[model samples]
Target: MVLIGYWLIEKLFTFEAYKTRNNRGFIIRQITHHKTKQEKERQREKLINMEKRVLYGLVVMLMYLVGGGYSQGVVEWIRDKAEWEEILVKTEIHIGVMVTSPLCGAPCDIVNDQVARFVETYGDRIKFYKINVLETLFFALDYKILTVPTVIIFKEGTINLRFESLSDWGMFYELLVNSSILDFPPDLSPAPAPAPSDSDPDADLPPPLQSGE
Candidate 1:
């Protein structure tokens, strides 16, 4: 009653099944190639992102060198008796002892930068001076600056506060607020600057005198 012709069945098999089976390998290869291309594209994007980050950091450094974030020439370096006299006689002054030697590591440089950056705004009201211990070791010894990065505050021509190895802005802020000296940023505090152990110029100095001598 219902017998399909062999010729018609052969025609359908050749058009649909045979053709699809013949193209299956090519289709599989195309899919594999597209997957590989997508993976390569992802890797390329990641590499580009990494390069952009590095470039952005370089741009920031260049801008800073050109006086981008803060104004330059505010913090003066102290290296002579005349300069010391000026700071000493000033009504309000901040003297920072910093290490400028090539061997100075992260901690020393960080503390030095903290003071230098802070002086951008405060320098107008109060004088600020930086003493490089490597250049002028005598000043460090005279001021008892055993720490590589110590900040000594002078108000009314007298030593007001001595911050030894000053690490963060919290202690500096609190002290200044209590003394009514400097109004520093409260929430924008940076990471504490610790004393570098191995490569500090201050380490070569004679050990601190024992108590009750």
Candidate 2:
């Protein structure tokens, strides 16, 4: 009876040892799996952070490029401001003197047309002021303009050139050209004659009847 009891106890203790070993193996596997999952999560977080940093850097670089281009454009535009201002001021004042009475007819019209042409041609370089003789007799007398259409080129608030009747474009152009106000030469060529065509009636005119024997 004692031997039988001792054998049964030994068998039970061996079975209990096998169960304990298996439980220990399962606990070790669970710990290893948990560690692997934690490591993967940490790597994913690092990659996301890296991507964010790269995106931020790109945004900063783009902003700098835009800002720098804008600054350069603004600087260039400001650089031309002074030259434009000087041109505006000079163009507001022009080269003309007051004309007084004893002036009328074709001469008056010619002078007015000349002044208008001067304004058209040199509008960018000079100003035009017209003082009619009948209207501004006092001013014409003050300038001692005995002639009907007298011109005075004013520079720096002083008289530069005084000339009588600009009867032709050449005469006026010469006045400014000699004084350095007109830098370029004017066109002086005569117009060309029209070409003959078969469709023209004059071209188809019959020759005079023969009279010679």
Candidate 3:
């Protein structure tokens, strides 16, 4: 059988012999000192065990590549696409903030922070979703997003407001209030200035009463 012949060949020529000499020297050495029956059998078993381990490792690697790169990758892509499609179809108040990258700049950070606060304040009334323009190009194209740090608000599946560029939290709050999405207006009043302190060392001290009150 092919396996028997292959095993015989391996027993006759091993890695140790290959490292030591040319083909002529290897043949002469093999002929001069033929291994004992027990030694030959032990070498054959060792080679077979090594071959099995290598074959097993290759099979496991192949399975992992197929499962993770092909199967799971496709499944996740479909799921995410479906979720975004559903968001577009649903008739609800939804706010989508489009950004090129989450950690790109101060503008992106400010927009995210404002949206997060808005969501926390009115989460029960509206839904908020953050869309990365680079990662979700299809969604960005569908929504016609042309710039980073863009905020789009939808009411009953219609775009109610769209804002672009960096903006302060007060501006966003005012916009949401104007759109009537928020029931109550956000307090945009400037913080009161602290009263002047009497701790200044250079201040004119009251003239000491000249030894009498």
Q: How large is the C-alpha RMSD of every model relative to the true structure?
A: 22.0, 29.8, 21.1
Residue-level lDDT tens digits of model 2 in 105-198? 4444444444555555566555645556565545556577777666666655567667775534224544554565565455679989876685
Whole-model alpha-carbon lDDT for candidate 3 = 0.60
Count of backbone collisions in candidate 1:
0
List, in order, the clash count of every candidate structure: 0, 3, 0
lDDT of each: 0.61, 0.56, 0.60
lDDT of 1 at 155: 68
Residue 40 in candidate 1 has what lDDT? 100
Candidate 1, residue 45: the lDDT equals: 100
Residue pairs in clash, model 3: none
lDDT of 2 at 33: 97
Candidate 1 residue lDDT tens string, 1-213: 134577787788789987898699789999999999999999999999677556545544554676554435366678876767766776444443343444544444444445556566455545666777777777776777666556677767667677765444324434544554555434667889886688678975799988994
Between candidates 2 and 3, the TM-score winner = 3
Give the per-residue lDDT digits (tens) of candidate 3, residues 1-213.
Answer: 999999988977886586667777878878766666668889999999677556545544554465331221111121256776677687355545444465445455445545655565666556767667777777677778777777777776677777875434325645654566765555789999876567884455566667765
Worst 10-residue lDDT window, candidate 1: 167-176
- Best candidate (score: TM-score): 1
**In model 3, which regions exceed 4 Å deviation?**
1-79, 166-170, 183-213
